[model samples]
Target: MIESPGLLLTLLAFVLVIGPLVFVHEMGHYLAARWFGVKADAFSIGFGREIAGWTDRRGTRWKLGWMPLGGYVRFAGDMNAVSQPSAEWLALPEEERNQTFQAKPVWQRAIIVAAGPVVNFLLAMLILGGFAMAYGDTRTPPVVGTVLENSAAARAGLQPGDRIVRLGDRDIHVFEDMLSYTRIHPAEKTTVAFERNGQVQTLPVTIGVDQQTDRFGNNYRIGMLGIARGDRVTVPVSLFEAPVVAVRRTGEIVSMMVETIGQIITGRRSVKELGGPLSIAKVSGEQITLGADAFVFLIALVSINLGFINLLPVPMLDGGHLLFYAIEAVRRKPVGPEVQEWAFRGGLAAILGLMLLVTFNDLGNFGLWQSLASLIG
Candidate 1:
C-alpha cells in the first residue's frame, strides 16, 4: 500500500500536475475573451473557498481556492465557471447587455470556448514531442529474462539468456513485438524460436488465461507470457528524429483512447477502468517516483485526456457550445433560452453522474470499499 509520505506526495503531485494545466486551460478562454473585447469577472485556480484573491488591473478577480481539483474563467454575466451564457442578465439595458456573453457574436463566443481544449491538446503534444527528442526510447531485447517455475516456459525447457528470434515463422524486430502479440493470443500453442549459448532452439509453449482479481474483487482473465523482461536496449536519436517519435507516441495515445472507448461500448471493457481525480493523484505520485521524465509524460497524457473530454459534443461543454454556435452561425440566430437551459441541464446531469461513478471506482481502487465489504460479508 502507498503510505503516508506517498499519500502526501500523491496529493502534492496532483496539485502540481493539475494546477498549471487547468490554469493554462482557463487562461485560453480568458485571453480569447479579452481578444474579442469581452470582460472576464474572475479567473480562478481551483474551486470552493477562496484562500487568496486580488483584483487585477482589468478588474478581474484572480483567486486561489482551497479545493485544487479544477479552475475556471468567469466571463461577465456568466452564472458560473462554464461558458454557458446567461439570458436573464441580457435583459438589462443595452450598456449592460454589451458586457454580457450572450451579446457576443457566435464566432467570437465559439472561439473563446474552444480555445481552452485546443490549448490543452497543443500543450500536450509539445510536451510529448519534447520528451521523445530528449530521452529517446527504451525497449527490451527479444531475450528471455526469467522463466516462471513450472510455467509453460519452464515446461518447454526455455531458459534465461535466450534471445527470441521469432514467434512462429514471423521475424521479431523487438521484445515488445513478441509480448504484445502473445498477450492477445491466449489459450493457443505456438512455437517460439530463440538463440541460446550460440545455438538456435525451438520451444513449443501453450498459452492459457490466468484469472486475477482487482483491488475491488473484480475478476479478469489475462493472458500470461510467463516471463519477466530483463534484456533491454535504449535507442538514442537526434533532436530531428524526436518529432517523429513524438508524433508516433501521440498517435498511439489517440489510438488507445479510441480503442478504450470502443471496448467500453462493446462491453469488452468495464466502466470500472475509468478513473477520476483520485486515480490521477495515485498515478501522479507513482509517476513522480519513477522520475521527472515519467512525471512529464503522464502529465502530457492527462492533458490529452482533458482536451479530448472537453471536445465531446455535450451541452455545457466546450464542444457542445461549439455545436450550438455552429448552428447559430448557420441559422443566424441563437437557440431558444429554454432549449439551451434544458440541454445544459442534461449535459450537467450526465457529467455529474459519470463523476460520481468514477469517484466510486476510485475509492474501490483504493481498496476502501473492499475493506467495508469484507467486514460486512
Candidate 2:
C-alpha cells in the first residue's frame, strides 16, 4: 500500500469511486429481483463482518458490512448467490419454494440478472448528455492554432489562424465534431476547406499514418492530416430541452464502447488498453485531485466500466448467467448441472488469473515492487 502520493490516490480512488459504483450496480439487480417477486433474504452492502444492519418488515436483512469493494443480494433459495444452480432449487418441494428464484419465469430471471449492469450504463449516458446540454459543450473554433513545421498540414500550405470550414462536404461547427469525423474516416486524401483571415480557401492534403508504440511493445498506426486541436467554445443549452441531454450522452458512451470492442477485435486497438483495479485506482486518485466535477466524472466513467465488464460473456459474470438464460430460452431447458459446474469453475479461474495479472501490472506501473526491491537490496 505504501508508494507515491499517486499510489495513495489510486487506492483511495478504488475505495471511494468503485465502492459507490458497486452499490449502484447491486441495487439495480436487487430492484429487478424484487420486481420479479423473488424474495431476498439478505441485502448486504459489502462483505465480512456486519457494521450496521436492520431487518425489513418482509424479513429481509438490510446490512452494511466492513469491506466496501462490492455487495450482494441473497435470495430466499439461493445457495450463496454466486453459485445458484437451477437443478438443486428445482428439487425443492413445490409447497416449500414459491418465492425461490428457480420458480421465476425465464424472462423475469433474465431481467433480474441483467438489470444491474444496464442501470449503470443508463446512468453514465444520462450524466454525459445532461452535462453536455446543461453546461453546453466546450469546443474549439475551426481556426488553426499552430501548424507544425514540415508536418503534412504545414507542407500542404495550411497556415496558422486558418479557420477550417469543412471536411469533404461535411460542415463542422465545433472542434469535437471535426475530431470525431476525422478519427473514424482516416482518408489518405482530404479536401479540407478553410477561411484564411476573412477569405475562404481549400487545401487538398495527403493524410499520413503515424506509428505509435504501446507499453507492451505493440505498435499502432494512427492517421493524421497534420492538423492540431483548435481553441474551445462553450455553447449552452436552451430552455425546456436540457433533460434529453443525458439520453444523447448515453448513446454516445454506448457508441464509444461498441467501437472500442470492435477496434480490439480488428487489431485497431490494443488489449493492454484495458486496465484492472490498479488503473481504476490511479484514475480515481488523479481525478479527485482536479476537484469535484472531475471527481464526479471519474466516478461515472468507472461506473460505466463496471457495467461493461460485467456484461462481457465471460462465464463467472452476470453476463455469463444471462448467457445461460439465453441458452435455456432457446433449448427450453437449463444446461446440465455438471456442465454448469465445470463452466463456473473455468470461468472463476479465468477471472482470478486475470485479476492477478492486472494486479502485477498495476504494481509495476506504480513502482511498488521496484521500490521494495531497492529497499531489500
Candidate 3:
C-alpha cells in the first residue's frame, strides 16, 4: 500500500539493501556446499515464485524470487530451504547418497550451515573498516568544558574545566563513554568523580532524564548532565588499522544488541521498540538520503544484527543447527526426527508471531493506525 514517489524510494532502497545482503548470505552457503562436495539444488535470493533465473553449469538453479524479505539455499537432500532431510534423499541410490546433505559428516554440515552467518559478520567488518579508512575517527575528550545552569552537573556543584574521571565504579575515557553510561541509566543517581584544581572530588549526582524522539518517531530517554565539549577531535587512521577498528566496532554493536535483547527478554525494556520490515525500509530510505557513507554504515550495522540474530540458540536459526550438532555429539546420534519436527514447527510459529508483533509496531511508528483512527473519528 505504499504510494507514489515515497513508495518508489522505499522499494528501491529496500531492494538495494536487502538484495546484496541476501545474495551474500546465500552465496556463503552455496560456496561452502560446493567446497564440501554437496550438491545444491537451488540458490535463491528471495522466497516464493521465481521472477527470473538461470541454471548454472553445476546444475544449480540460481533465481530471484518475488519476495525480497528472505532467501535460502536448497542442498541436494534438503526437505526445504531449512535443510531438513527429504525422503527422496533418504531413498537415493547408495552411490549417490554421498552427495546428500544429511549424509555428510556432522562437522561438514555444521560448517555449511555456519558459513552464511559467518559471511555476514565478515561483510559488516569489511564495510565498517572501509568507512574508517575513508573517514578518520572523530572523538571528543571527556573533559567538562561547560555546565548548564540549574542542570544536574551544576546542581551537583560541577564547574567548567573539570575533568570527569569516573561514573559509579566505571572509568570514563571519553565523552562517548560517559554518554553511553548515562543513556542506559536515565534519572538514576550515581557517584561522579571529577578532578578540579588538581584535586579529585567525588559527588553524588542524580541524572536528569530527557525524553526525545528521532525523525522516525521512535522515542528514547537519555540522561543529561548538561555538559558540552569545545570541539571534536579527528584522528587519522591507516587502511591497515581500519580492520582492527572495524572489529572493535562490530564487537561493540554485538555487545549492545546482546544487552538490549536481554533487557527486552527480562521486561526491562519496552517491546514497542521492536521493529520489522517496514522500519527497515523506512530507515533504508532515510539513510539513502543521508549519503553513501551513512547508507553503507547502516548496511554494516544491519549485517551485524542479522549475523548475531541468526546465531541465537533458537530453533529454526543457524544456532539451532549448531545446538543440534552439540547434542548429537554428546548423544552419539541426531535428535529424534519427531522431536526436531515439533521443535521446528514451534520455532516457525514463534518467528511468525514475532513478525506480526513487530509489523504492528512498525505500523504504529509510521502513524498508519493513527491516521486511520482520525479518519474514522
Candidate 4:
C-alpha cells in the first residue's frame, strides 16, 4: 500500500475548491427556478450515484454524489440535467404544467439558464472585491529596471529607465499589465511603445518563450520578456472604489483568457496548454500550501473560468441554451426537438473529446507515459 500525504492533500484541496463552486453554480439555477415559480425536482452537488440525500419540504431531492467533478439542478419538466424539455412533461395536466420549467416564458427561461454563469462571475467578483478592499491594489508603474543580456527586451533596444506605454494595441498602465500581455504572446513578434528621455519610442520584438515546471512536475510554456520592473507599490483602494477595481481586474482576466484562446486557435499557442480536473487538483494543493489567500485567489480564478466556459456557444452548455432562447425570441418559436437533440449529441461528443485531450495532457505532464514505459522495459 502506498500512502502519500501530498496525494491526500491534493484530493482534499480538489474537493474544497470544486465543492463550493459547484454548489454556488447549481444554487444559482435553483434560485432562479424558484423565483420564476419553476419547480426544481432535484439539486445535486455532484453526479453519479448519490452518497447521501434528503427530500426538502418542496420535494426537491438534495443530494451529494460519489463524483465531485460537476453538478446540476434538475427542474420539473426537464428530461435531464441539461434542462431539455420532455414530451411527456409538455402533456402534463395544465395546473402541474404551469409550475414546470418548460412552461415559463422564453425570456424567463433564458434568465434561468443564464443565472448560473452570471452568478459564477459574480462570485469571482465578490471574492476579488474583498481582496481589493482588504489588501488594496498593486499600482506599480511599467518602468524597466534591468534589461537582461540577449533577452527580447534587450534585442528590441529596451533599456533601464524606459517606461513601457503600450504593447501591440494594449495600453500598459503597470508593469504587471505588460507582463500579462507578453506572457500570452510568447515567440510572437509585437510592437512595443515606451517612453525614454522624455520621448516615446516604438519598436518591434519577438516575445521569448520560457518553460516553467511546478514542484508537482506540471509544465507551462509562457511568454517572457527579459526586463524587470523598477519597483512595486500597493495603494489602498476605498470601499466604493474596490468594486471598480474588482470589475477591472475581472475584465483583464477574461481578456487574457480570450487572448489565450485566440492564440491557440491561430496556432501561436499549443493546445497542450489546456488543463483539466487533474491540473486543478495539483494547482489547488500547491496553492493551499502557499497560504489561504493564494488558495482563495485560485478559487476566484477558477470561478471566472467556469463562468467563461459555460458561456461558450457550444451545445449542452448554458451558452448553448441561451443561444436557443435567442433564436426562439427572434423566430417566435423554440427550436425543433430533433435539431436540439442532434446539437446536444454533437455538444456532448465535443465536450467528451476536450476532456480526453486535457486528461491526456495532464498525464503527459506528470510523465505517466515515461513511467509506464520504464516499468514495461
Q: RMSD for each model, in Å, please? A: 6.1, 5.8, 3.1, 2.5
Specify the highest-TM-score model's number: 4
lDDT of 3 by residue, 118-175 (tens): 9999999999888778877766788888898888889888888898989976688777
Model 2 TM-score is 0.75
- Score residue 304 of candidate 3 by CA lDDT: 88
The better candidate by lDDT, 1 or 4, is 4
lDDT for model 1, on a 0 to 1 scale?
A: 0.79
lDDT of 1 by residue, 1-377 (tens): 22333678889999989998999899989888888888888999989999999998988999999899889888778764444455667566888668767678888898999999988888887887787666667666877889898777787787888888877545666787676556545566888888988998888877656787643234555556687778568788677777676766676677558766776777766788888999899888877877898898898999888888898899977899888888889988877767887888999999999999999999997889999999999
Of the candidates shown, which would achieve the greatest lDDT relative to the real structure?
4
Q: Write the per-residue lDDT of candidate 4 for residues 89-180, one digit (tens) a residue.
A: 76789988889888899999999989999899999999999999999899899999999998999999999999999999899998889989
In model 4, what lDDT does residue 340 have?
Answer: 85
Residue 57 lDDT in candidate 3: 90
lDDT of each: 0.79, 0.75, 0.83, 0.90
Runs in model 4 deviating more than 4 A are 1-5, 80-87
Ranking by lDDT: 4, 3, 1, 2
Off by over 4 Å in 3: 1-5, 80-88, 165-171, 188-205, 213-220
Between 2 and 3, whose lDDT is larger? 3
Model 4 Cα RMSD, 1 decimal: 2.5
* lDDT value, candidate 4, whole model: 0.90
Query: How many steric overlaps are in each model, in order?
Result: 0, 10, 0, 0
List TM-score per model, in order.
0.74, 0.75, 0.89, 0.94
Candidate 2 vs candidate 4, lDDT winner: 4
